[model samples]
Target: MRAILAPLWNNAYLLMTLTCLFWAGNSVIGRAARDLVPPVGLAFWRWVLAFTLLIGVAWPYLKRDREILLKQWRWVVALGALGVGAFNTLLYSGLQYTTAINALLMQSAQPPLIMLMAFFLFRDRTGPVQIVGVLLSLVGVLVIVAGGDIDVLIHLRLNPGDAIILGAMLLWVLYSVLLRFRPPVHPLSFLAATFGIAILFITPFYVMELMAGRRIVPVAESFATIAYVGIFPSLLAYAFFNRGVELLGPGRAGVFLNLMPVFGSLLAIALLGERFTTAHAVGIGLIGIGLLLTRKA
Candidate 1:
């Protein structure tokens, strides 16, 4: 029994699972608050809160690594802009027009897209297994888009949110690849720096959203959503994910991302009373198989 449960006790597995669970909750929150809070406002405030809390906790390490952090400012800014700012802002924006289940299902494309991007940018090679995995995952995503009916492909209609979410997923893949260049600081320090940078990048867009008449009202629901996002997805999830990356390496760590759609869809069903259809199960199953195959790929 001890041997059977050994993998569950590992930090990588625990961290990765927790990270996915937090992100799954994020999808629910984002979708729930889509009408109450402006996307840019939510993105900005989430990072502001995350940065303030992180800097308070991690200031010692950040101060010690000030020189190294400055030297790596470019990578930090790029990572912050893509991962923390753009990806989340886009995700929240898309949630305005999509279900949490659909948004997360679209995100299932990330690993395969990362493989392609890595291949193009870094000349990383993919095996036949990876190619097969990519194909299977792509089919699953299409099934989700088609809503269990192949005839929907005749017109191939897509929600506007799906396109936006695709962009969000790609930004996250780029951010993941770019993490290799981050300075060797404590994970807390790294998160603090990125959160600050992300806040800086998002401020302008948030202002624009305000100027465009999408002002965020001060309401309990909005603040509650922001508070949840700031604490869970922005802070703890990032910390857990970075630690998991450290423990398992990016390739292996990424395989656990398959759990996001599963958890997200379940939460959506349980909390939002969304339907669980055969299409969802079939799509999730194929995506899970694809992600598992990537281990050998």
Candidate 2:
């Protein structure tokens, strides 16, 4: 793996950074999309479209590896639940009740929390430096989620948005560990299958909502939002992320995703008119330092 990845790390780094930015933009999209589409409807259709694209693009491989994918059906379903079903669903749902800044801060906790969960769940070894770095990054995450207020964190009264974001974190952690464990048949083929199968999983919930008559009323603007989610975050971002994981390996690639919150916060300010404050600056510095310390030296 090292020999294969060494030559591609540079390109992977660039691609992953772009993935982070895309995800940050996704947050903005979700926020802007509120009220225009039902959260569940947006989540459901994005995957439906993504599934279509992946099927077309990976049709040859999908046919070739049909047996292997069939054999790994459980993993595919598991990954689909965590990666597509849970993550995107929670994101859209949270955006309904929370500010984009709140959502981004909560999502930012993924890297450190994933490391901590891996250590405990899998008995992975952790050094003092790593533990400290994780803790430091976690503190930053807490600060951001608390809206730059230590008092709110101290009170332990986290906002509902934070809870939703935490759910997204847990979903991804499970996805990460699952990827490490019963990996799909082939990396690229697996990614394609994982995404291609998402629509099937999300369809039931969408159907229920539609039966209840709460589906987003289709309009030109609504179509644009769904199309944006399909192409940008679901298709392009996943492609970038998979290429990064293939090139840099999952560990390094995971750490690079830390940039998502930073980018999200900045974009929130620029696009959403969120105020930039001292606490945000401090949190950024701490998370940056933590990532630097955790990086392979």
Candidate 3:
């Protein structure tokens, strides 16, 4: 098991790419299920299921790392609140009103945001090459967001949903930046602790959502959405992203998020029968070049 997993665990690029793939799928699915699953309710259950699935495997690591975890409880709580609790809930909430295109456009801001936060908060410096790379990727994102037409951006309007998604993006940026300070513990131990904290943090909001008459519709599609979100985006994506950040640093790791829109576009074509266009090819090419440049930096 160690031998098979070690190679993957060491491959930061692969981890981050997979992370974006899962997250792209997450955005698509979240949008599709918005009517079926309420935001806070979806978030609450997503963490609940992730925690349930993780705790069993993490128990031994938790026991072994109890002292370290307890010592670093503050970081655990902060990360849980920002990354698992607020970000995801707000994302789902925002998706309720926004088109997936708008959401992906919002997501494109993450790399620069993460870079800026890292610089301001920690004095982390970004090189010129990285800056150029980020700009290229941003253009790629714009091409995709605008559906190959620049005029679409001119006519784009921001609504409450866009603001909500921006707020979520900011929270995730903070989470990614602060992950540098995470305690030295087994990945499983950290994830388990944070997952538990996320559940605790989200409980009241979930209850309030219930009180407000925003209940999840009980249906097969809702269950399937919950199940997929619980396992892929919640469990695997977070783990892979955290490790990728650990290996590559927040600035570099964040550049990979540019791929989310790229993958999201392809996923749409494959799943929704959307047409593949020249813009997608050009945008994907630019994003690929940007990633390679960032990697070199």
Per TM-score, the best of the predicted structures is 3
| Model 3 per-residue lDDT tens digits across residues 1-297 | 999999999999999999999999999999989899998899999999999999999999999999998898899999999999999999999999998888888899999999999999999999999999999999999998788997898988888999999999999999999999899999999999999999999999998998999998999999999999999999999999999999999999999999999999999999999999999998999999999999999
Show where candidate 1 strays beyond 4 Å: 1-10, 99-102, 130-147, 152-156, 275-292
lDDT of 3: 0.94
For each candidate, how many residue pairs have backbone atoms clashing (under 3 Å)?
0, 0, 0
lDDT agreement with native, every candidate: 0.79, 0.72, 0.94
Find the 10 residues in a row with the least total lDDT in model 1: 248-257
How close to the true structure is residue 246 of candidate 2, measured as C-alpha lDDT?
60
How many collisions between residues are there in candidate 1? 0
Greater TM-score among 1 and 3 belongs to 3
lDDT of 1 by residue, 122-181 (tens): 876677886786677667766655668877667644689888988898888888766767
Supply the TM-score for candidate 1: 0.84
**RMSD to true structure for each model, in Å:** 3.9, 3.8, 0.8
Instruction: Report the C-alpha lDDT of model 2 over 1-297, residue by residue, as the tens digit.
Output: 878865654477678878888887887888887878887788888887877777765777777888988887888778877887878888787788876555655666676665666667776566667656666666665665566876765665457876787787788777765566444455557767777666677778778877888767667878998898988888878777766766654545566666777777788789779898887788778877776676542
Query: For candidate 2, what is the TM-score?
Result: 0.83
